[model samples]
Each structure stands twice: as C-alpha cells, then as structure tokens.
Target: MADLKKTELEERAFETAKTLLAKYQNPHNLKLEENSNLEDCYTILITLLYAEILEETEQLAILSIIDGMKLLDGNR
Candidate 1:
C-alpha cells in the first residue's frame, strides 16, 4: 500500500518549493533560503517529519527528497 501521508507531504513540499523558486533568482541564495524554511515551510517540515519515521530513517530518504525536488525543478 502507498504511504498516503508521505505522498501528501511531498505535494506540500513541492508547492512550497515552487513558491520559493519563483521568488528567488540565485541558486546559492535560493538553497540557503530553502534551508532556512525548514523552520517555516512545508518542504522542510514534511521532510523532517518523514525523516523521523523508521522507514525513512535510511540514507535513501535522501533520494526521495531529491525526487521531490525534481518535481519542483520540472514544473519550473
């Protein structure tokens, strides 16, 4: 079965990423800001939540995060 909560969080993170990507122009600064949003946006919030789950505790969660990031990149 699919992990619906994880999927929903991914969507929220993607949306937050979209908004940040639109407002920021520099890649360096964008990454910095995005990192900061971990305290403020769903992107970081969701990842942090998932990161705590035993299933996502593995390093491959990094890949999952990257894939979610691609969704933002592809849309923009």
Candidate 2:
C-alpha cells in the first residue's frame, strides 16, 4: 500500500504517528489531542495495532496509522 494515495487527513495522521513514535521510545509516552479527528485516527491505530506498537515492530508506527485510515475510510 506504499503507492496508495493518501488524503490530507490520512497524511496528517500518518505524520503525527511517525513524529510521536520518533519522539518517544515507548508507546506509553505517546499522546494525542483528545476529541479530534487526529485522536480518532490514533485510537483506531492503537486498537488495531497496539501489539505492534508494544513490540516496537519495524520502528514504523506509521503502518498502524495507515491501517487506521482503512477503518476511517470504511466508515465514510
């Protein structure tokens, strides 16, 4: 899905995830602004891919962010 086109919101969420993942070594330190779409994206990502975050898999929390877009897109 690397070549898949991402909407602006998706891109924002992806970037946010990457930034947060990079700033903190542990997922527990990550925080999202509540009651916003960005937070919603993070919620989906965490719910679906928390294990990956906990494992620090591939150093790419962006994967979860991308996958979270699928859930959001499906709802739309």
Q: Which stretches of candidate 1 lie over 4 Å from their true place?
A: 1-35, 38-57
Worst 10 residues of 2 by lDDT: 27-36
lDDT agreement with native, every candidate = 0.46, 0.56
lDDT of 1 by residue, 1-76 (tens): 8643435435555555554445434333334243343223444434444534433333344455566666767999
Best by TM-score: 2
State which candidate has the highest lDDT: 2
Give TM per candidate: 0.29, 0.35
- Deviation (Å) of 68 in candidate 2: 13
Report the Cα lDDT for candidate 1. Answer: 0.46
Compose the digit string of candidate 2's lDDT tens values, residues 1-76. Answer: 4655656766667566565555446535444443345666566456435544344563355565566667877999
Candidate 1 pairs with clashing backbones: none
- On the 0 to 100 scale, the lDDT of residue 15 in model 1 is 54
